[model samples]
Structure formats: structure tokens, C-alpha cells
Target chain A: MVRQERALRTREALIESAATVFDRDGFSVASLAAISSLAGVSNGALHFHFSNKAGVADAVEQAASERLERLVAAHGEAVGSALQMLVDTSHRLARRLGEDVVLRAGFELSRDHVRQGGRDLYRQWHAWVEEALKRAEGEGALNGIAPEQVASSVVAATTGFEVLGARDPKWLSRRTVTRFWQLLLPQLATPPVLGSLVAAGGPPGDHARRTPGGSPAARAGEEDD
Target chain B: MVRQERALRTREALIESAATVFDRDGFSVASLAAISSLAGVSNGALHFHFSNKAGVADAVEQAASERLERLVAAHGEAVGSALQMLVDTSHRLARRLGEDVVLRAGFELSRDHVRQGGRDLYRQWHAWVEEALKRAEGEGALNGIAPEQVASSVVAATTGFEVLGARDPKWLSRRTVTRFWQLLLPQLATPPVLGSLVAAGGPPGDHARRTPGGSPAARAGEEDD
Candidate 1:
């Protein structure tokens, strides 16, 4: 059991390191040597966990996909209305993306042309947004506009925020997202549903806060010491 | 005069070739040899025109910027209201970006981390959208929403369309953009202004149509025949 746990830790470390390097250097230029060095693992250990650079990237993308799934599921369970869920989820996503290098790198990799065929995190996110909007439409939450149109707009704007946030972190800030929701909610919700919707949603906890060493992998490494 | 014209044609060919390769291979992996070969120009001619790949990228960006400026200016002259101009310009841009390799390459390079300290086409587009929104607000064309908030939403959505369009040309279709405006315009414009606003805008000319060999540089090459 102890050996399994150690193996898992090493895998996590490698994934995090790969994400950091990929986020900084981009997938085309990111090197396995740099990833292993950052993870504090031997070259042999890196190869043991993953066969090649693409394998490392796949692992990072898989980890990010799992986190995104959990985030969506958690929000799905908590919110009463689909529109409110979307509003709250957008806020949460922007916050998490700001703080999580793995998530950010996964998204960057999705848009990247170099890596062919993996879990496309953006498409996954877009699918969820589309599903939520359809649910909202069924519930009579939306105004006269078609659900698909709203879905397209929401997906585009959120993706924009993600793209721009790379250069300026402010694009992913809670305030910026809140403002976006404020402007959009009025246009999106029906008059009856509009009164109940909260554009800001609930406050995110300390986990959502930005930190210098932000990834869960980094925090786990700290615990070992 | 003939010599100067030939030199200009060679420069255009190199820029077009660079945009095509950069769009396909991305900045990091793109090579001068590939660009020169695609342009059908000698390596000597390529070097004479551009010091390096970055210089080639800068020239493509510069050309894209000029086209964007001309697009905005043309719309500004044709439309009476700032809001109308915004709508018309957006439709034109989506169409142009779909047809123009240089414009698409310029935007992709703007978000690319490999290159730095060039004209950020996205930022330039965002600034223009912001200015238009502010002008619309001054004209009392906007509803209750703040111009800044609308600007943020518009910029994000439009940028989203640009980014997503890279993968799916449908994202840049006139129908998609028109639907976006149809959904947004009612919420954005005052009831009085809403009545006058056209969601589809005027039809784009044949020049805006997608072609296999679309770039003006390619057309200029054809003229030589």
C-alpha cells in the first residue's frame, strides 16, 4: 500500500511539472528533461510512468479532464436552477483556472495544433455549457432566444476569457466574470426567472484563491517535507 | 517602376507563404526554408526581405493590421450610428477572418507565447469594440447596461468566435454572427434604437467569400499570369 501511494505521488509530481512547463514553454517546445527536473524525479522514473513526451501530456490532460468533471458534477449537485448553476460554475471555473496550472495547461493544449487527439477540455466544457443551457431552456429559464444561440455566446465568451487570461490574469478574475454575468444574465433569463438569478453566485473558498505555488501537486510536495 | 513592382510582389509572396505555414505549423515549428519554398522564392530573396522568421511574422501582422484598419474605416464611413458600425464591422471581420490567411495568422500569433512584443491584434480589436460601445452609450443607444460591461462581453464573444473559428469555419459564418447580433441587439439597444438596428447588416461582397487561394498575395500572383 505504501509503495502504491509513493508511485501515485510520483505520477502526480510528473504531471504537475509537465503542466507547468507546457503552460510556460508550450507543448511543441516543452522538453521531458525539464519536466522531470521540475518534478525532482529521475529520468528513469519519468520513463517508467510515461513512455514519451506525448504520454506525459496525455497524463496532464487526463488529470485536468478529471478535475473539470468533478467541478461540473459538484456544481450540478449544489445548484437548484440550471442558469444559476451556469453562473456559479463560470465564476468557479474562472477562479480555479486562475489558481490551477494543470487546468490552464490542459486548456492551452486543447487549442494547440501540435498535439493531435486527446481529451479536448474546451470541447468538454462547451458540451457541458450546451447541456446546461438546454436544461435551462426546458425549465423556461431563458428568454425568447434559442438555447443554442445562448450556448454559442456563453461558450465563445468564456473561451475568450480563457485565451485572454493567459496574457492578462485579470481576464480570469472573479470581478471580470461577475461583470460578464451581470451584463449577460439580463439578456439571457426570462423576466420571471431573472429576479431569482444571482449573477455573482456564492463566494468561493480559500481553495479558489491564487497562490505563488498553486497547483495541488505543489501543495502535496510541500506536505512531504 | 517594373523592378520596384516586382520587389513588392516578392515581398507579398513571402508574407503570404509565411502566414500559411505559420497557420499550419505554428510559430515555434515554422521554418524559413518552408516559407521560401512555398513562396517559390529563393532563400536569398527571403533573407533579403526578412531578417528571420520573426521579421516575416511581423510583416504578416502588419499587413493584417492594415486590412483591419481599412475594414473599420470602410464601416465607419457607411454607417451613421456607432452601434450600427459595430454590428457591420463585426460581420465584416468574421467574414474576412474566414477568408484572409494573414488576418487569421495575425490573430493566432497574437495569442502565441513563442513570439513577443508585436502588435496584439486581439487587443487592438478589443480596444475598437470598447470605443464603439462607449460611443453608443454617449448616443443613448445602449440600454441600462454599462458600456464597459457590454464592451467586455462583446470583446470576449468576438474573440471567442475568432479562436473557435480556427478549428471550425462555421463559427465565423455570417449566419452565426447574425444570430449572435439577433440575440444581443435587443438586449443591448434601447427599445427605440432596437427597432432601427439590423442584426444581419448589409451583405458582404464577393471579396469576402472563401477561396482556396484566398489571400490578396495569391490574387496578385494570379494577376502576373
Candidate 2:
């Protein structure tokens, strides 16, 4: 049991190392040697865990997807209107993206044209956002706006934040995303529901703790894949 | 004059070739040899026209930027509401992105985080979009939604389309972009002006022709850039 635990730990270390290198130098240029060395593992061990660079990337993508799934699930469990949950969840996602390199690398790798057949983070997020908005629609919390339209815009904006944040960290800041909700919610909600939405921070019961700004390794909202 | 024209053509050819290779193999991995070979130019000829790969990429970006500038200018000259102009311009851009490899490559190259200080296509697009929406506000065509918020969402959606298009061409299709505007415009415009906007197709006078789907090299909106 101890040996099995150690093997799992080594694999986790290797994935973390791979995320670091892939995040810095995109998938096409990142080297396995760099990842193995950063993990303090031998090349033989790295090969044993991952057959190739694509395998490492697949692992990273899977881990990130799992993190996102957990985030969505947690937000769903929170008590509030679905719209508020979405607002608060958007804040958490933006903050988590700013803090976690593994998540960032997963998104970046999915965008890589060379990498094939891995977890498509963008599509997954799109479906989740659609589901959340649909739930809001079911609750009659939405204004006249169509759920699918709102879903598309939300996915585009959040995904754009991730893409832009890769170049400028400020795009991932809670302030930017909050401002997004602030501007969009009034238009999206009927007058009666407008007061119920929180744009600059999160829902009243939301326990989303902010990560320290500018620290990629902070991992405040982290979870295992 | 003939000699000068020939030199200009050769330089254009080199930039186009560089864009092709750089689009296929990213900026870091693309080699000058491949670019020259694709252009059918000798090594010395390629060097005479461009100092290095960065030089080639800069040329492509400048050309694409000029094309985008001209597009905005044309839309500005058209007779209609600024909101209509913005809608028509977006349609043109989505079509151009589908048809023009050089323009697409220019955008991809600008997104390369490793390549610093070149023209930031995303930022430039963001500013131009903000200006257009501000103009719409100046014309008093905007509804309750703030111009800045509309600008932010437009940039995010269009830029998201571009990034997503890199992986799937369907994202850049006129149908997809048109659907975006159709969904977004009602929320952005006052009731009186909403009727003036065109979403699925171009404005009455908009000459933004559609390229047959699945053809990357068909330059439907080609200008002298």
C-alpha cells in the first residue's frame, strides 16, 4: 500500500512538472526532459508513467477537466438563484484560472491543434454554462433573453478571459469578471430579479475565497483530478 | 518601375509563404528555410526581403492590420447607423478569417506569447470595437446597456470566435457569427433602432460576400493589403 501511494505521488509530481513546462512553453515546444528534470524523476520513470509527451498532456487535460467539473458541482450545491450561482461561479473560475497553472495548461493544450482527442475544456465549459442557464430558465429567473444565447455569450466571455489571461494576467482577475456580470446581469434579468444578483463579488452565501493575486502556484481552489 | 514592382511582388510572396508555414508550424518551430522553400525563393533572396522569421511575421501582421483598418474605414463610409456598420463589419471579418490564410496567420502569430512587442491584434481589435460601440452611443442608438460593457462582450465574442475557429472552422462561419449578432443586438439597441440591424446577412449595401465553406484560400473580401 505504501509503495502504491508512492507511485501515485510520483505520477502526480510528473503531471505538475509537465503543466509547468507546457504552460511556459506551449505543447509544441515543451520537452519531456524539462518536465522529468523538474519533477526530479528519471527519464525511464517518466516513460513508465507516460508513454510520450501526448500522454503527459492528456493527463494534464484530464486533471484540469476534473477540477472544473468539481467546481461546477460545488457551485450547483450552493443555495441561491441559478443566476447568482453562475455569477459566483464565474468569479471562482476566473480566480482559480489565475492561480492554477495546471488548469491553465489544460486549456492551452486543448487549444493546441497538434494535440488530438483529449478533454476539450472549452466544449465542456460550454455545456456546463448552458446547463446552468437552462436551470435558471426553468426557475423562471431569466428575463426574456434566451438561455442558449446567454450560454454562448457567457462561454465566449469566460473562454476569452482564459485566452487573454494567458498573455495578460489581469484578464483573469475577479474585478474584470465581476464587472462583466455587473454590466450583463441588468440586461439579462427582469427588474424584479436584478436586485438579487451580485455583480462585483459573489452570491451572499458563496464561500469562494480569493487567491493571492499574481501567484500561479497559490492553488487556493484546488482539487485532485 | 517594372523592377520595383517585381521586388514588391517577391516581398509579398515571401510574406505570404512565411504566413503559411508559420500558421502550420507555430512561430517557435517554423524555420526560414521552410518559408523560403514554400515561396520558391533562394536563401539570399529571402534574407534580402526579410531579416529573419520575426521580420517575416511582422510583415504579415502589418499587412493584415492594414486590411482590418481598411475594412473598418469602409464600414465607416457606408450609409447607415454605426450599429449597423459594426454588424456588417463583424460579418466581413468572420468571412475574411475563414477565407484568408495570411490574415488568420497574422492573428495566430500575434497570439504567440513568445513573440513580444509585435502588433497585438487582439488589443487592436478590442480598441477598434470600443470605438465603434462608442460611436453607436454618440448616435444615441444604444439602449440601457453601457457602451463599455457592450464593447467588452463584442471583443470577447469575436476574439473567442477567432481562437475557436483555429481549431474548428465552423466557429468562423458566417452563420455562427450572424447568430451571435442576432442574439446580442436586441439586448444592445433601443426598440426604434433594433429594426435597422442585420444579423444573418449583411446590410442592404454591405458587399461582404460569403466564401464557399471549407475553402481557406478563397479571398472573398480581399483588399490591396
Candidate 3:
């Protein structure tokens, strides 16, 4: 078991190194020698683990899919009002800002390889988001629309948010994410109960939330106009 | 001007060819010779136009940006309900489906020295979304919430939808996109008038939309839950 664990660590090291380089250069130009050098292993060792560049990339893509699936699952038990669920998922969302590039790029890579990990990851993510919408619908969240519509919109929003956020943390900060949830989730939450959830505290831990010269809440409300 | 036009065409040919090659193959294996041959130009011509492989990628990135910018500007006349604006943008968005590798990769080319176009593109998209949300508020289409949040969510959702749609046209068909507009835009449209827009056919000359249950839509909504 200990030997197995060491072998796994070497494999993970190669993947981590590959993710960073691929996130910077992509799988094509990032050479095996470079990846091996970055992993502090010899070419022979890298070859032992991954036969070549695509082998490393394939592994990285798989790990990225698995990690994303785990993240969504971690937040699975927190389903509630859109705002509350978003808030619960807010930190999880914010924490991953910009570093989720491996997964983000994997989706694009999937386009090239139809059997790529990006497709599977998104499939899983959409499934998770769909489940959330159904629960929200059962709770009387959507006013009168199909729960499917809400699910599609939410999944799209989450994937887009992650891709953009992985590139720029501020683009999908805690408050920004919460604010998004408050507005859109209301469309799927119990209509009467949405008011309270939407009115929840101004993005928990954000100091810059309120904006200047006017309350942040007012600015948010202005958007609704 | 004739000489300039000829040079421009050759340069464009190089970039276009290179973009296709890179999309199909990673940076490491996509040779300039292959790219040149694909464009029906000589390797010497390709090298003269782009001093380096990275130069070719930069030009492709620039071209993609300009094309995207042009598309957005063409839709500049989109005003009134944020929802309508969103729906109008879908037409433009649809055209990007199955475009060159550069548009799909956007920023995943970290291997080269090129900047990730994803960041700038997303920021621009977010700003545009934010403005539309504000307009929705002014028209009294919103439910008195923060536009930034809604904007982020809308931006996230739209980008996500487009990305997913690009991979599987069936997953994000014209109807699926319209459904997205129907689901999201109504929440932002004022005077409670999504009935005609959502249920109505596409803009003049566009096809009439089916009521949301194609194989792709069915599969998508069920998972993006």
C-alpha cells in the first residue's frame, strides 16, 4: 500500500506540473522534457508514468473532471432557497477562482477529442445543477416555468462563471456570485419565500459590496429596474 | 492598395490555416510546414508572415477578437428589455458555433506567450450584460435586485450555454438558446411581456421555435439541472 501510494504521488506530481504548464502554454508546446524537468523527475521516470505528452494531458483532464465532480458534490447537501444555496456555495465558488484552468481548458480540449473528459465533467455538473433545480421546484421556487429551463440556465451560468472566474477572481467574487444567485435563483425559488432570501445580508464577507455614494442594496435593486 | 490587399490576404490565409491546425493538433505537434501546406502557401511565405509560431497564434487571437468585437457592435442596436437584448445576441452567438480553434480555445493557450483572450472577452461580455441588466431595471422589467449579480449570472450562463452548444449543436440548438432567453430574459423584461417574445417565433425571417423538447434539449435540461 505504501509503495502504491508513492507511485500515485509521482503520477499526481506529473499531472500537477502538466496542469500548470498546460494552463500556461497548452498541451502541444509543453514538452515531455519540460514537464519532466518541472516534476523534478527524469525523462525515464515520466515515460514510466505517462507514455508521452497526450498521456499526461489525458490524466490531467481526467483528474480535473473528478475534482469538479467532487466540488459540486461537496455542496450538494446545502440545497435550499437559491440565495441560501448560492451563499452556501459562494465560498466554494470564490475559493476556486482562476485556478480551475485545467478543467476549464479541458472542455475546449474535449472539442478535439469527442471522448474527452470535459464532456463528462460538464455532463456531471449539469446533472448536479439539474437535481438542485428539481429540489427548488418541489419547494415551489419557480413561479410557473418549467424546471428544466431553470436547470439549463443555471448550469450554463455556473460553467461560464467557473471559466471566467478561473481567469479572473474578481469577475465572480463572493458578493458578485451571491448577487447573481439572488436575482436568478428567485426565478426558480418559492416566489413568496424568495423575498427573504433575496434580502439576506449583503454578501456575508464582502467589504466592497455596498458600493460608494449609495447602498450596495440600492445598486442591486437598480439592476432589477 | 492592391499590393497591400494581396499581402493582407496571404497573411490572413496563414493565420486561418494555423488556427485550424492548432485546434486540431496541440501546439507541440502542429508544424508550420503543415499549416503552410494547409493554406496552400509555401513554408517560406508562412515564416515571412509570422516570424515565429507564437506570432501566428497572436495574429489568430487578434483576428478572433476583432471578429467577436464586430459581431457585438453589429448588435449594438439591441436596446429595451435585457431579455430582448439577450435574445438578439443569441443570433450572433450562434454564428460563433464551430468557428476556428482560436475562438474555442480563447485563453487556454497558456503554452505560448499569447494572452488568454478569455479574460478580455469575458470582461467585455460582463460589462455588456451589466449594462443590459441596468436597462432592464430602468424599463421596470426587473424585480428590484442588483443588476451586477444578475449580469454576472447572465453572462456566466450565456457563455456556458455557448460553450456547451459549440460542443454539441443539438445540446444548444436555436430553440434551446431561445428557451434560455425565455427563462432568463423574462425575469428581466418589464411590463410582463415575455409571452409574445418567448412564445413567438424568431425575428423576422428566422424559423419558428418548437416548444423546447428536441433530443438535445431533453438531454441537456435533464442534466444541467
TM-score of each model, in listed order = 0.89, 0.86, 0.74
- Candidate 3 lDDT tens digits, A120-150: 6667666766776666667776666676666
User: Model 1 off-target regions past 4 Å?
Assistant: A203-225, B203-225
Number of the candidate with higher lDDT, 1 or 2: 1
In candidate 1 the C-alpha lDDT for residue B98 amounts to 83
lDDT of 2 by residue, B1-225 (tens): 999999999999998888888888888888999999999989999999889878888998998888778867876565568887787777778778877888888888888876764787888888888888888899888875567767766777787888888878877776566656655676678778877666554444565365443122211121111
Fnat for every candidate: 0.56, 0.28, 0.56
Docking class of 3: acceptable
lDDT of 3 at B71: 58
Chain A fold similarity by TM-score, each prediction:
0.88, 0.90, 0.74
Ranking by DockQ: 3, 1, 2
Model number with the top DockQ: 3
Q: Could you list the iRMS of every candidate? A: 7.3, 6.1, 4.1
Give the per-residue lDDT of model 2 (tens digit) for A127-213: 988888988888888876678767766877787888888888878776567646655676577677776566654533454464343
Best by lDDT: 1
lDDT of each: 0.79, 0.76, 0.59
Highest TM-score scorer: 1
Write one digit per residue (lDDT tens) for candidate 3, span B93-157: 55464544566444334323324333355556667767766776776666555676567766776
